[model samples]
Target: MKPFFVILLFSFLILIGCKGEEPLNDSIIIEVKTAGEKELSDLINNRNGKYLFLNIWATWCLPCVEEFPDIVKLSVNYKSDKIDFASLSIDYIEDKENKVIPFLTKMNTTFSHFINGFKKDEALINFINKEWSGAVPLTVIYDSSGKQVAMLEGAHTYDEFADKLNTLIK
Candidate 1:
Protein backbone atom coordinates (compact mmCIF):
# COMPACT_ATOMS: atom_id res chain seq x y z
CA MET A 1 0.00 0.00 0.00
CA LYS A 2 2.87 2.40 0.86
CA PRO A 3 4.65 1.67 -2.45
CA PHE A 4 1.44 2.14 -4.38
CA PHE A 5 0.79 5.46 -2.66
CA VAL A 6 4.29 6.69 -3.54
CA ILE A 7 3.85 5.73 -7.20
CA LEU A 8 0.50 7.51 -7.35
CA LEU A 9 1.99 10.60 -5.73
CA PHE A 10 4.86 10.60 -8.23
CA SER A 11 2.45 10.27 -11.13
CA PHE A 12 0.35 13.09 -9.82
CA LEU A 13 3.39 15.31 -9.49
CA ILE A 14 4.48 14.53 -13.04
CA LEU A 15 1.03 15.27 -14.34
CA ILE A 16 0.96 18.59 -12.53
CA GLY A 17 4.46 19.61 -13.62
CA CYS A 18 4.35 18.54 -17.24
CA LYS A 19 2.30 20.98 -19.26
CA GLY A 20 1.06 19.77 -22.65
CA GLU A 21 2.10 22.95 -24.41
CA GLU A 22 4.04 26.10 -23.74
CA PRO A 23 2.27 28.94 -22.03
CA LEU A 24 0.31 31.04 -24.52
CA ASN A 25 1.08 34.72 -24.71
CA ASP A 26 -1.99 36.86 -24.93
CA SER A 27 -0.77 38.57 -28.07
CA ILE A 28 -0.61 38.16 -31.84
CA ILE A 29 2.15 38.83 -34.37
CA ILE A 30 1.32 40.05 -37.86
CA GLU A 31 3.59 39.63 -40.87
CA VAL A 32 4.61 42.76 -42.78
CA LYS A 33 6.29 42.79 -46.14
CA THR A 34 9.60 44.58 -46.34
CA ALA A 35 8.49 46.05 -49.62
CA GLY A 36 5.07 47.17 -48.54
CA GLU A 37 5.02 50.13 -50.85
CA LYS A 38 3.63 48.16 -53.75
CA GLU A 39 1.16 46.32 -51.61
CA LEU A 40 -0.01 49.47 -49.91
CA SER A 41 -0.44 51.13 -53.27
CA ASP A 42 -2.36 48.19 -54.54
CA LEU A 43 -4.60 48.11 -51.50
CA ILE A 44 -5.34 51.79 -51.84
CA ASN A 45 -5.83 51.71 -55.58
CA ASN A 46 -7.96 48.62 -55.67
CA ARG A 47 -10.27 49.63 -52.84
CA ASN A 48 -12.61 51.28 -55.29
CA GLY A 49 -15.77 50.35 -53.46
CA LYS A 50 -15.20 47.47 -51.06
CA TYR A 51 -15.53 48.23 -47.37
CA LEU A 52 -12.30 47.59 -45.47
CA PHE A 53 -11.96 47.22 -41.75
CA LEU A 54 -8.33 47.57 -40.75
CA ASN A 55 -7.57 46.88 -37.15
CA ILE A 56 -4.16 47.78 -35.77
CA TRP A 57 -3.24 45.87 -32.67
CA ALA A 58 -0.32 44.48 -30.64
CA THR A 59 0.30 41.40 -28.52
CA TRP A 60 1.06 43.37 -25.36
CA CYS A 61 -1.94 45.63 -25.61
CA LEU A 62 -4.59 44.42 -23.20
CA PRO A 63 -7.43 46.21 -24.92
CA CYS A 64 -6.29 44.85 -28.24
CA VAL A 65 -6.33 41.31 -26.89
CA GLU A 66 -9.71 41.80 -25.33
CA GLU A 67 -11.25 43.18 -28.49
CA PHE A 68 -10.08 40.41 -30.80
CA PRO A 69 -12.79 37.91 -29.97
CA ASP A 70 -15.47 40.40 -30.93
CA ILE A 71 -13.59 41.21 -34.10
CA VAL A 72 -13.68 37.54 -34.98
CA LYS A 73 -17.37 37.44 -34.19
CA LEU A 74 -17.94 40.49 -36.31
CA SER A 75 -16.11 38.88 -39.22
CA VAL A 76 -18.27 35.81 -38.91
CA ASN A 77 -21.45 37.84 -38.76
CA TYR A 78 -20.65 40.22 -41.60
CA LYS A 79 -19.72 37.89 -44.38
CA SER A 80 -20.45 39.69 -47.63
CA ASP A 81 -18.90 40.33 -51.03
CA LYS A 82 -18.50 44.04 -50.32
CA ILE A 83 -16.83 43.75 -46.95
CA ASP A 84 -13.18 42.94 -46.19
CA PHE A 85 -11.64 42.43 -42.77
CA ALA A 86 -7.94 42.63 -42.05
CA SER A 87 -6.20 42.48 -38.69
CA LEU A 88 -2.69 43.83 -38.55
CA SER A 89 -0.64 43.24 -35.43
CA ILE A 90 2.12 45.65 -34.63
CA ASP A 91 4.06 43.08 -32.62
CA TYR A 92 7.79 43.18 -33.11
CA ILE A 93 9.23 41.08 -35.91
CA GLU A 94 11.10 38.80 -33.49
CA ASP A 95 7.89 37.78 -31.71
CA LYS A 96 5.80 36.87 -34.77
CA GLU A 97 5.61 33.08 -34.74
CA ASN A 98 6.99 32.64 -31.25
CA LYS A 99 4.56 34.74 -29.23
CA VAL A 100 1.93 35.92 -31.69
CA ILE A 101 1.17 32.71 -33.55
CA PRO A 102 0.92 30.65 -30.37
CA PHE A 103 -1.36 33.20 -28.77
CA LEU A 104 -3.67 33.35 -31.77
CA THR A 105 -3.67 29.58 -31.97
CA LYS A 106 -4.61 29.35 -28.32
CA MET A 107 -7.37 31.90 -28.75
CA ASN A 108 -8.65 30.09 -31.84
CA THR A 109 -8.83 33.36 -33.80
CA THR A 110 -9.78 32.80 -37.44
CA PHE A 111 -8.96 36.27 -38.77
CA SER A 112 -5.89 36.58 -40.94
CA HIS A 113 -2.92 38.21 -39.20
CA PHE A 114 -0.33 40.53 -40.66
CA ILE A 115 2.86 42.05 -39.24
CA ASN A 116 3.34 45.77 -39.58
CA GLY A 117 7.15 45.80 -39.75
CA PHE A 118 7.55 49.51 -40.11
CA LYS A 119 9.71 50.56 -37.16
CA LYS A 120 8.55 54.13 -36.96
CA ASP A 121 5.38 54.38 -34.93
CA GLU A 122 4.72 57.84 -36.28
CA ALA A 123 4.98 56.59 -39.83
CA LEU A 124 2.57 53.79 -39.09
CA ILE A 125 0.22 56.26 -37.46
CA ASN A 126 0.37 58.45 -40.51
CA PHE A 127 -0.17 55.47 -42.73
CA ILE A 128 -3.27 54.49 -40.84
CA ASN A 129 -4.54 57.91 -39.87
CA LYS A 130 -2.78 61.20 -39.44
CA GLU A 131 -5.17 61.94 -36.59
CA TRP A 132 -4.45 58.65 -34.84
CA SER A 133 -2.51 59.24 -31.64
CA GLY A 134 -0.54 56.02 -31.86
CA ALA A 135 -3.16 54.21 -29.86
CA VAL A 136 -3.43 50.43 -29.71
CA PRO A 137 -6.66 48.64 -30.54
CA LEU A 138 -7.44 51.12 -33.24
CA THR A 139 -10.08 50.32 -35.81
CA VAL A 140 -10.46 52.08 -39.14
CA ILE A 141 -13.34 51.49 -41.48
CA TYR A 142 -13.03 52.57 -45.08
CA ASP A 143 -15.85 52.84 -47.52
CA SER A 144 -15.95 51.08 -50.84
CA SER A 145 -14.37 54.07 -52.51
CA GLY A 146 -11.44 54.22 -50.04
CA LYS A 147 -13.01 56.94 -47.94
CA GLN A 148 -12.74 56.90 -44.18
CA VAL A 149 -16.22 56.08 -42.94
CA ALA A 150 -15.75 55.36 -39.29
CA MET A 151 -12.89 55.14 -36.84
CA LEU A 152 -12.91 53.74 -33.32
CA GLU A 153 -10.03 53.79 -30.89
CA GLY A 154 -9.86 51.68 -27.77
CA ALA A 155 -11.68 48.46 -26.87
CA HIS A 156 -15.31 48.03 -27.84
CA THR A 157 -18.05 45.50 -27.20
CA TYR A 158 -19.27 43.01 -29.80
CA ASP A 159 -22.64 44.72 -29.95
CA GLU A 160 -21.02 48.08 -30.53
CA PHE A 161 -18.80 46.67 -33.25
CA ALA A 162 -21.70 44.89 -34.81
CA ASP A 163 -23.77 48.04 -34.74
CA LYS A 164 -21.02 49.99 -36.44
CA LEU A 165 -20.69 47.28 -39.07
CA ASN A 166 -24.43 47.28 -39.56
CA THR A 167 -24.39 51.00 -40.23
CA LEU A 168 -21.86 50.48 -42.99
CA ILE A 169 -23.59 47.48 -44.46
CA LYS A 170 -26.93 49.22 -44.67
Candidate 2:
Protein backbone atom coordinates (compact mmCIF):
# COMPACT_ATOMS: atom_id res chain seq x y z
CA MET A 1 0.00 0.00 0.00
CA LYS A 2 2.84 2.40 0.94
CA PRO A 3 4.67 1.64 -2.35
CA PHE A 4 1.52 2.28 -4.40
CA PHE A 5 0.91 5.64 -2.68
CA VAL A 6 4.52 6.73 -3.28
CA ILE A 7 4.33 5.75 -6.97
CA LEU A 8 1.07 7.65 -7.38
CA LEU A 9 2.59 10.77 -5.80
CA PHE A 10 5.66 10.50 -8.05
CA SER A 11 3.49 10.16 -11.13
CA PHE A 12 1.49 13.24 -10.19
CA LEU A 13 4.65 15.24 -9.68
CA ILE A 14 6.01 14.16 -13.07
CA LEU A 15 2.77 15.08 -14.80
CA ILE A 16 2.79 18.52 -13.23
CA GLY A 17 6.43 19.03 -14.12
CA CYS A 18 5.82 18.02 -17.72
CA LYS A 19 2.84 20.28 -18.15
CA GLY A 20 3.34 22.67 -21.07
CA GLU A 21 2.06 26.16 -21.65
CA GLU A 22 -1.09 26.74 -23.66
CA PRO A 23 -0.52 27.14 -27.39
CA LEU A 24 -0.46 30.73 -28.66
CA ASN A 25 -3.48 30.08 -30.86
CA ASP A 26 -5.52 29.08 -27.83
CA SER A 27 -4.30 31.94 -25.63
CA ILE A 28 -4.41 34.92 -28.02
CA ILE A 29 -7.56 36.30 -29.61
CA ILE A 30 -7.52 39.00 -32.30
CA GLU A 31 -10.48 40.42 -34.17
CA VAL A 32 -10.28 42.13 -37.57
CA LYS A 33 -13.20 44.33 -38.49
CA THR A 34 -14.12 45.65 -41.93
CA ALA A 35 -13.82 49.38 -42.47
CA GLY A 36 -14.84 51.51 -45.42
CA GLU A 37 -13.89 55.09 -46.17
CA LYS A 38 -16.41 56.50 -43.74
CA GLU A 39 -15.52 54.03 -41.03
CA LEU A 40 -11.83 54.73 -41.46
CA SER A 41 -12.44 58.42 -41.36
CA ASP A 42 -14.44 58.00 -38.19
CA LEU A 43 -11.60 56.16 -36.55
CA ILE A 44 -9.11 58.83 -37.58
CA ASN A 45 -11.40 61.56 -36.33
CA ASN A 46 -12.18 59.92 -33.01
CA ARG A 47 -8.89 60.24 -31.15
CA ASN A 48 -10.45 60.08 -27.64
CA GLY A 49 -7.85 62.49 -26.26
CA LYS A 50 -4.91 60.30 -27.29
CA TYR A 51 -2.52 60.53 -30.22
CA LEU A 52 -3.26 57.84 -32.78
CA PHE A 53 -0.63 55.89 -34.69
CA LEU A 54 -2.31 54.15 -37.62
CA ASN A 55 -0.50 51.91 -40.05
CA ILE A 56 -1.99 50.98 -43.40
CA TRP A 57 -0.80 47.59 -44.61
CA ALA A 58 -1.76 44.40 -46.45
CA THR A 59 -1.05 40.71 -45.96
CA TRP A 60 0.42 40.41 -49.42
CA CYS A 61 2.75 43.39 -49.12
CA LEU A 62 6.25 42.21 -48.31
CA PRO A 63 7.44 45.56 -47.00
CA CYS A 64 4.45 45.76 -44.71
CA VAL A 65 5.13 42.31 -43.35
CA GLU A 66 8.80 43.10 -42.78
CA GLU A 67 8.11 46.25 -40.80
CA PHE A 68 5.25 44.85 -38.73
CA PRO A 69 7.34 43.42 -35.92
CA ASP A 70 8.90 46.83 -35.35
CA ILE A 71 5.44 48.36 -35.17
CA VAL A 72 4.47 45.73 -32.62
CA LYS A 73 7.52 46.56 -30.54
CA LEU A 74 6.74 50.26 -30.74
CA SER A 75 3.19 49.63 -29.62
CA VAL A 76 4.49 47.79 -26.60
CA ASN A 77 7.10 50.38 -25.63
CA TYR A 78 4.85 53.41 -25.92
CA LYS A 79 2.54 54.32 -23.08
CA SER A 80 -0.92 53.25 -24.17
CA ASP A 81 -2.74 56.18 -22.55
CA LYS A 82 -0.60 58.78 -24.34
CA ILE A 83 -0.63 57.08 -27.73
CA ASP A 84 -2.89 54.45 -29.24
CA PHE A 85 -1.78 52.08 -31.97
CA ALA A 86 -3.87 50.45 -34.70
CA SER A 87 -3.47 48.81 -38.08
CA LEU A 88 -5.61 48.79 -41.22
CA SER A 89 -5.16 45.93 -43.62
CA ILE A 90 -5.87 46.54 -47.29
CA ASP A 91 -6.39 42.85 -47.81
CA TYR A 92 -9.82 41.95 -49.12
CA ILE A 93 -12.63 42.22 -46.58
CA GLU A 94 -13.47 38.56 -47.04
CA ASP A 95 -9.97 37.64 -45.82
CA LYS A 96 -10.39 39.51 -42.54
CA GLU A 97 -11.01 36.36 -40.53
CA ASN A 98 -8.77 33.81 -42.19
CA LYS A 99 -5.86 35.93 -43.39
CA VAL A 100 -5.84 39.29 -41.61
CA ILE A 101 -6.84 38.11 -38.13
CA PRO A 102 -4.49 35.14 -38.31
CA PHE A 103 -1.54 37.32 -39.29
CA LEU A 104 -2.31 39.80 -36.54
CA THR A 105 -2.70 36.97 -34.07
CA LYS A 106 0.66 35.55 -35.09
CA MET A 107 2.17 38.97 -34.47
CA ASN A 108 0.48 39.05 -31.02
CA THR A 109 -1.29 42.30 -31.78
CA THR A 110 -4.21 43.20 -29.51
CA PHE A 111 -4.90 46.70 -30.78
CA SER A 112 -7.67 47.79 -33.13
CA HIS A 113 -7.44 46.22 -36.59
CA PHE A 114 -9.52 46.67 -39.71
CA ILE A 115 -9.65 45.29 -43.24
CA ASN A 116 -10.47 47.38 -46.28
CA GLY A 117 -14.18 47.60 -47.04
CA PHE A 118 -14.19 50.27 -49.73
CA LYS A 119 -15.88 49.54 -53.02
CA LYS A 120 -13.09 51.33 -54.89
CA ASP A 121 -9.45 51.32 -53.87
CA GLU A 122 -9.15 54.89 -55.13
CA ALA A 123 -11.77 56.06 -52.70
CA LEU A 124 -9.81 54.60 -49.84
CA ILE A 125 -6.59 56.25 -50.97
CA ASN A 126 -8.27 59.61 -51.47
CA PHE A 127 -9.87 59.40 -48.08
CA ILE A 128 -6.58 58.62 -46.37
CA ASN A 129 -4.56 61.20 -48.30
CA LYS A 130 -5.01 62.32 -51.87
CA GLU A 131 -1.25 62.53 -52.15
CA TRP A 132 -0.72 59.05 -50.76
CA SER A 133 -0.58 57.47 -54.22
CA GLY A 134 -2.10 54.27 -52.79
CA ALA A 135 0.95 52.94 -51.03
CA VAL A 136 1.14 50.14 -48.49
CA PRO A 137 3.04 50.46 -45.20
CA LEU A 138 1.78 53.99 -44.75
CA THR A 139 1.95 55.37 -41.23
CA VAL A 140 -0.34 58.23 -40.29
CA ILE A 141 -0.15 59.98 -36.97
CA TYR A 142 -3.00 62.03 -35.61
CA ASP A 143 -2.93 64.41 -32.70
CA SER A 144 -5.26 64.34 -29.72
CA SER A 145 -7.48 66.83 -31.53
CA GLY A 146 -7.89 64.42 -34.43
CA LYS A 147 -5.62 66.36 -36.73
CA GLN A 148 -3.20 64.71 -39.07
CA VAL A 149 0.24 65.56 -37.80
CA ALA A 150 2.42 63.35 -39.94
CA MET A 151 2.11 60.97 -42.85
CA LEU A 152 4.97 58.58 -43.51
CA GLU A 153 4.97 56.42 -46.63
CA GLY A 154 6.82 53.12 -47.01
CA ALA A 155 8.36 50.82 -44.40
CA HIS A 156 10.41 52.41 -41.62
CA THR A 157 12.78 51.00 -39.03
CA TYR A 158 12.12 50.91 -35.29
CA ASP A 159 14.42 53.84 -34.68
CA GLU A 160 12.69 55.91 -37.35
CA PHE A 161 9.36 55.17 -35.73
CA ALA A 162 10.69 56.06 -32.30
CA ASP A 163 12.07 59.35 -33.61
CA LYS A 164 8.74 60.27 -35.15
CA LEU A 165 6.89 59.28 -31.99
CA ASN A 166 9.28 61.23 -29.79
CA THR A 167 8.75 64.37 -31.84
CA LEU A 168 5.00 63.89 -31.48
CA ILE A 169 5.35 63.53 -27.73
CA LYS A 170 7.43 66.66 -27.57
| Top TM-score prediction, candidate number | 2
In candidate 1 the C-alpha lDDT for residue 84 amounts to 78
Off by over 4 Å in 1: 1-37
Instruction: Please write out the lDDT profile of model 1 over residues 57-159, one tens digit for every residue.
Output: 8899999998988887788777664777777778887887787776666665555567775667777788778888888899988887877888899988999
Clashing pairs in 2: none
| lDDT scores of the candidates, listed in order | 0.75, 0.89
CA deviation > 4 Å runs, candidate 2: 1-23
lDDT of 2 by residue, 32-149 (tens): 7788877887888887788999999999999999999999899999965489899999998878877888789889986789888889999888888888978789999999888889
How close to the true structure is residue 30 of candidate 1, measured as C-alpha lDDT? 38
Candidate RMSDs in order: 6.4, 3.6
Candidate that would win on lDDT:
2
Query: What's model 2's TM-score?
Result: 0.84
